[model samples]
Target: MLGSVTTVEGIHYKTKEPVTIHIEHGRIKDIQPIAPDKNNDSLPWIAPGLVDLQINGYYGSDFNTIPIAKGSVENTTRGLWKEGVTSYYPTVITNGDEEIEQALQSIAAACDGDPVSQAGVKGIHLEGPFISPEDGPRGAHDKSYAKAPSWPLFQKWQEAARGRIKIITLSPEWPGTIDFVERCVDQGVTVSIGHTSASAEQIDEAVKAGARMSTHLGNGAHLMLPRHPNYIWEQLSQDGLSACIIADGFHLPESVLKVILRTKGEKTLLVSDAVYLSGMAPGTYDNHIGGRVVLTPEGRLHLAENPGLLAGSAQLLPWGISHLVKNGLAALEEAWDMASVRPSAFMNLPSQNGLTIGAPADLVLFELIEQRMTIVQTYKQGNRVFDLTTSTKE
Candidate 1:
């Protein structure tokens, strides 16, 4: 339907129809259904490239490792292209004040110096130092630095990030949570509740004060809590809060995931929450959060000494999406949207338009063989960036 444009053809990820997408000037120009060809069976599925809201690092690049090596962020950006991530938030977890400021500065510097870093690093996700210091609810974050929120301290880090800190995850159990959440909202920063042991009333107050989301809702919490009115239940009850779940299979079971999907509906979004060891082979490694963690052959990352305790998520969004589909927790289309347009819409990003006449041409082509998703090609702004058939691919 569009004139003289470079077109990409594949089966639509949602409709399952063979179509040709016309691209021009870095956006979608038109999309038209095409008759199935003899080789249609070999064509990959096409959909919007993934948008990850929480990711620490990838491959050997660790964002939490302060004074991050030069080119690390840039390398990670290109590395994720093979996995179909077009936009992502580089997460900075709980740490000493000076260390956290330095980490933000390094990331901001990377974005300022490199075009690739600027393109991929949508914003910074400040995940704590303001979270709960309680044992189980603290998850793997270091407790020594956990403290109450301070607007002045946060302003210092924001200055280091050059105003790129878009999301802050904190616990409402702290005394000044309402005021902090309000200030963050006023600055156009999204406040997400996480790592908490907050009571029902505290959660309600935070939601009323402008906390709009939950960071990996089910993971950062007390392992044991009363069944009646827990923080998890409270977050689930808040229709105003969007739920971000780690569907990596090791985090939440099918039933809970189903409940979240049903409760949140269009508000459900997926986050990788992946630590630095995500793409590494199964092995033991020194982690910043947990003293020593082991990445199992099954891809689960757990504390080495206590095999039963999870250290952090080692799988990314593609694997999480695959797990949901493999377990019948969500349809392929819905699972894909949870990692794509749904998250984009929650963040109010331009990619939320998704597969329409004028959406950004951030697209991916992939296969779903045996319920496992594999990226065949990825395009950002209508330009092919990764292809499976090439040696340059990851």
Candidate 2:
């Protein structure tokens, strides 16, 4: 149980043993197993704070909204903390030049102003404007603003964002993209292939140019395609490219999720790809991008006018991890690694901070009951950022 001190006792994520973690100066001081405390009602499992590489928004706050609402970014970070996410990328999708500029500037200002934003919002994810204009590959992004890749434009956005844009997702089919990828990699920014209709040869060229990841691998493509030589299979076959899957059960079928998990193995990661309506009530709602969309009782978010195509997801990373575990797609430890260890490792960030000494004290205390996960508490840098008892939590 959490007390008035920085030392916390729970089951270690790796060893599955009861242990006590001592924290000092916002870093883990030591981890030692202690005798079982019979008084504890729930044997909460302690794991590294979950990291989400792509999140558009949560609750009623949309990260892409121009002239960002007051406290919107802060509110999103706080809401994610309750869901066990301590680090994430505030994803901005396809939009007009002015809207993208303002959104990135607002994010940079928010991070500069608040400690919570600085701790949780690791960087910005630009997911569009350089993607395919086709219906299936474009997904829900506004095609009017979509265009060929431009290095100068990205530099301007990076300037406005104060160098916080770390990941840029684009289609490799566009001309000059290979050169753009090379430039971005030179600057330490991760380039991911997404929203594309690129052929296998083009995919290989992207990898050669330093594209390190595939953004939401299975979702941003035509529903119907040739079984062979598809982008999904091509990405799956590439050993150098890490793939991020939604895994919320709504984005990809169970069988497909299993194949991607098995194929990618340790290189696989989980991304929410959650839109503005993620935590909102299930009903027909007018969205800025997907127009009229319906959030179902079972948490499926799809276009109301056309139910065939999904608008986005309505779940978070923790929920996705639970779904993977309960469906037998992965063991509990492997599923958790997809959300924490794998993503952090791919991002070049330290992994397993919860169990490592001298690492940041960011962690989540949760329990699995009847295959459902419950987040009991969350600590970021030795501070109690979220607790189950707080009513204003989400």
Candidate 3:
């Protein structure tokens, strides 16, 4: 058995005291608080590795556009590991039936019977084909194929996935959507709302039908709306609903992000709606969504013709955690929770607590030098997957 011991005293689960974590064979063996050690004083904060429930692609791979092969999925999974993402749901949005089936088949093949594959890829998040038809609300999704939820269609997709699809996102206002959400819930699949123009009443009905999450809550809608009585307010006030926000600093302004962190602490999860252009050098690129988008100097994706409209985000989970910390929106611990514990719970994953003995040995170590968080190491099942000190090698 291989093992390593790490003592982190400065920030443990958002606390000030130092905590020592023991790992053996990719499982957390022990966790305890201890007095600071002079030798370990330089070590920075340690926390559970991040989990993102909605990631389209990273490091130049677009889940929707890339041919689903083990090599493609493996490359994408490895790319995410470098960002400290221990686990994520590969989001497949708005695509044709054949394309969706091919993508799902690829993911299942890549994940089957592989340990590292299991570590990062939980399952698929199907995000479209049942969204609103409005141009603005559809938010870059292909409108030609957009349609109302159909039970037969869902059954076909689920069959094509061979039970690998875990979550589905749709607009509740669509005909038969409520029944579809209920059916999906009954079948043990999560249903989330997105690309929607649902009213408060429609949202409530969907919630009652078992839609518990909102997909990228603030990004896929009209820019201006009645301040107090908007979809944002409705989602915020719903106690049972959990939402994900793209904290890449572009999807939502700092002030709005602060408000969300404050009001939805522990209730809100963060996602990188990162596209194919993520992690690539800044330049103009073609979005498979049939439009030209530019990778901004600040690492955000914007529509080439209309800079006001964001194409997607290049930020990963670590950057999101730092955004929360830098803006004072959440305490370091709280930000970590958004990235780790809360998201796991949202997805009903087995390991929801951070660094607890007997939990999966997925962890991230970072130094907060001068208030900037930098990932120093990443561990998956007690084995080092990413070490910034050395180049990434399989």
What lDDT does the true structure give each of the candidates?
0.91, 0.88, 0.79
Candidate 2 lDDT over residue span 50-87, tens digit each: 99999999998899878788788899998888888989
Q: How many steric overlaps are in each model, in order?
A: 0, 0, 3
lDDT of 3: 0.79
Q: Which candidate is the best by lDDT?
A: 1
TM-score of predicted structure 3: 0.93
Evaluate model 1: give its lDDT: 0.91
State the TM-score for model 2. Answer: 0.96
Question: TM-scores of all models?
Answer: 0.97, 0.96, 0.93
User: CA RMSD for every model?
Assistant: 2.6, 2.0, 2.5
Query: What is the per-residue lDDT of model 1 for residues 219-278, given as tens digits with 9 covering 90 to 100?
Result: 877778898899999999999999999998889988999999999998999999988888
Q: Is candidate 1 or candidate 3 better by TM-score?
A: 1
Cα misplacement distance, residue 58 of candidate 1 (Å)? 0.7
Clashes of 2: 0
